[model samples]
Target: MSAQDIARMDTGEIVEYEPVTPMELEFMIRELGARLENAVPVLKELWAARYSAERALIEEKAKAVLRSDARTITEKRAEADLATMTFRRDFDAAKETLHAAEELQKALASRLMGLQNINKVLGHAYGASR
Candidate 1:
């Protein structure tokens, strides 16, 4: 079979092939680490932007309620109450998302650290074997 066909085989499928070289593994780790490092900051910035937008929306809605005509006070109050509830719900959801992203970032950091340790150990083993 061609090398491409062999590479495409599923894990359980029998196919004779060499394992990934130490250099190839190191390169993959480095690439993944770089991508993860870049992603965390961008994710944090996006979360902050979303939070700011939501807060501004809530403030604008509050001002609108205050400026509404007295003739429609009852209707305006009801609308304001609904808007407040909706805003609270959205804010809560955003907070949850931010927490989730933070947790993911922590996990990624831990994984990256683990990969660095593995790379060091592998480098030592490869050098000793040579």
Candidate 2:
């Protein structure tokens, strides 16, 4: 996808973001990081909720029913790790968010630098006339 697609995500509903300075973009990235961390607490919360309430019952019933076919907790967890892959969606989202922030920052910095160069060139040309 292009930078605008990423920038749109960063600004939520505002694809046409206001003029962002490099410093402002830096702060926006920090805010995005904090928000992402807050959004993803469910990862640990889900693990704790499942492991606390259902681990013993699930292990017992599965072992009794399957006998030799039953897998150990570690094996089951590993399988579930692959099967659920809980972090996949969150990881992708975070990557996208970070990428959007990075793109926005780059664009703002470039614009600021270009303006500075233009002013410098104009100043030099004006000085040469004297």
Candidate 3:
């Protein structure tokens, strides 16, 4: 997509992003990085609330499944018993939450790295200008 499109696109919507010019890219990267660096912790808090809500629901369902399995286990160890039907469901949901959070963290980290790299470029740019 075009640079304008890249500028507008959120990280999730990114199809592909690569710098066209080192100097210009550095500027853009620095700007974006600085913004993200400031926002990372806030975004993390948001994610925590979102995922906690989701996990709560999943955990309830998982508990129900566990109770059911506990009641059923002594009679027979069926597919459901070995399957971790309850725990697995909860685990999967939690895993997804964690994975999403980690992705966000990585994105923020990338932005910070970009900012640092751009700062170096900016220093040179100003030096040259002087």
Candidate 4:
């Protein structure tokens, strides 16, 4: 009997067991065994499908993490590039200033040498006249 039928039966008195032939008992056992055997492949397929879906989800999550890391790396590289460019510009300006200072120093040294030569010539001329 089906579980629903058994549940709907009155609970006033215990039911008496009905006797069946040995052949009928054997047939029922074989039928139930066959039904269980038929269900095994279906259950296996369902389990495999569930496993595949879980693996796909894990792979997708990994891909998303990798994409995020790539974006972060790109941004960091851009920042580093900008910092390097700024440093190069400052270095170039400082180099130009240093060059200008060196040129001024050379000009001052030449002027001082010319003044000294003029002073020596005047001293010799005054000594000769005295």
Among the numbered candidates, top TM-score falls to 1
Any residue pairs clashing in model 2, and if so which?
A: none
Highest-lDDT candidate: 1
In angstroms, the error of model 2 at 44 is: 22
Per-model C-alpha RMSD: 8.4, 10.4, 5.6, 52.4
Cα displacement (Å) at residue 72, model 2: 7.8
lDDT tens digits, residues 1-130, model 4? 4322211223312123221444433343343344345545754665565555555544554444554534576665554444455444544555554454444335434433444455556567768999
lDDT of each: 0.63, 0.48, 0.58, 0.45
Candidate 2 per-residue lDDT over residues 24-113, each given as its tens digit: 444444444444455456444544544544554445445444443336876655554454344444444555555555455556445445
From the highest lDDT down, the ranking of the candidates is 1, 3, 2, 4
- Regions of candidate 4 where Cα sits further than 4 Å from its true position: 1-83
Q: Which ten residues in a row are the worst by lDDT in model 2? A: 1-10
Rank the candidate models, highest TM-score first: 1, 3, 2, 4
TM-scores across all candidates?
Answer: 0.57, 0.39, 0.44, 0.37
* Model 1 vs. true fold: TM: 0.57
